[model samples]
Target: MKFFSKRELIILTLLFVLSFVPVVGGAIRILEIAGGPSVAPDNPRISNDPFPALLHLLGAIPFCILGAFQFMPSLRRYAPKWHRLNGRIVAFSGIVAAISGLWMTNYYALSIEIQGDLLYVVRMVLGTAMVLFIVRGVAAIRGRKISQHHASMTRAYAIGQGAATQTLMGLIWIALLREEPTGLMRDIMMTSAWVINLTLAEWIIRKTNNLSVSGSVS
Candidate 1:
């Protein structure tokens, strides 16, 4: 499909706009809570964590930049290079986010409103998977297997960049269903968002004739 086509452009624009709102909202919430300019989560440990804070800051930048590139024709031509670089950035930053997020989840556990243990496990798993996916994607690219590399990188990027979709769906499902929503909202949001993104990415990867030669050989 033509991503630059009118309808695709509109959809992509909508998603990008949706992504912006939560970051702003979270920043405002942080300021209100701390009387400071920050995007700290409601966890004391996290508020005090310099390492994780740095990671989150770095991670968010690449996510926004690379995500924007997905829509820009000029930048799309540099896909292979950007894909590899973004994968490394996201993988490293994801590790920091997950580790720091675990502390926050523990704090939530103490509050008794959320199941911190479950969320912690899920976060750890997702983080590990994301890192592995990126590394493997890099390996595929290095081996000159563009198809596998593209598919794997796309999957990794989708999940890594899922912060917006995860948050939105988590809130939307909670608001509409009034149910606890199976699994943590973050996990569901991340997984569901990635599923959609990877599905579309897969189609594009195939169309670009970037699939691994090994697959085509068989």
Candidate 2:
């Protein structure tokens, strides 16, 4: 049997494509930190305390890329061991990403024009939610609540992908406004990205659950 249906293939393709820019950006940041002195003005926060940024990048890259494969039902069914192992990696990576994100948000001395009060609160709440969702997913799987585990992990992955959506949102903001986002507008754009991802995640979760119910009934 095919490892992925046409729909699954499409989803995976989109996920990878969305991940490309963010992954590359993370890699560049890592390289900048490793190469030499802090030259990037916008990156001084990370340059001063690179450990959390490094942890976040290391965790987020794997979680965003490898976690995409976990959505493939055929792969999960046919290669349970790989699925389980990858799931563990994804889960651990997700926790690290979320925690490090929170750490940076709290400690990083970004300008109010860049981060703002609203953005700070939003980041804290969403970061906390991502960690909780991943923990709940692990617990659900351990308890053999497969559907709950899937839903929770899907939500966590969606939150983890906020950076990709934020990139898209930033581009759109620049296009529409003819200038880079700043202050409250930047906060809105960033928050909207997370909201959009979570909304789509919920829709997918509900659709998948409905399909599963219909299949089981038939």
Off by over 4 Å in 2: 36-42, 216-218
- Candidate 1 structure quality by residue, lDDT tens digits, 44-147: 54455544444454555455444444434333444547644655665565555545554444443333234344555655666566667767876896798856
The global C-alpha lDDT for each of the candidates, from Candidate 1 onward, is 0.57, 0.91
Local error of candidate 2 at 138, Å? 0.5
lDDT of 2 by residue, 1-218 (tens): 67788988998999999998888888778777787544344577876888999999999999999999999887787889999999999999999999999999999898888899999999999999999999999999999998899899999999999999998889888888899898998999899999999999999899889988888511
TM-score of 1: 0.62
Clash number for each model: 3, 0
Mark the regions of model 1 whose C-alpha exceeds 4 Å error after superposition.
1-8, 25-42, 68-74, 78-112, 174-218
Candidate 1, poorest ten consecutive residues by summed lDDT: 107-116
lDDT, residue 194, candidate 2: 93
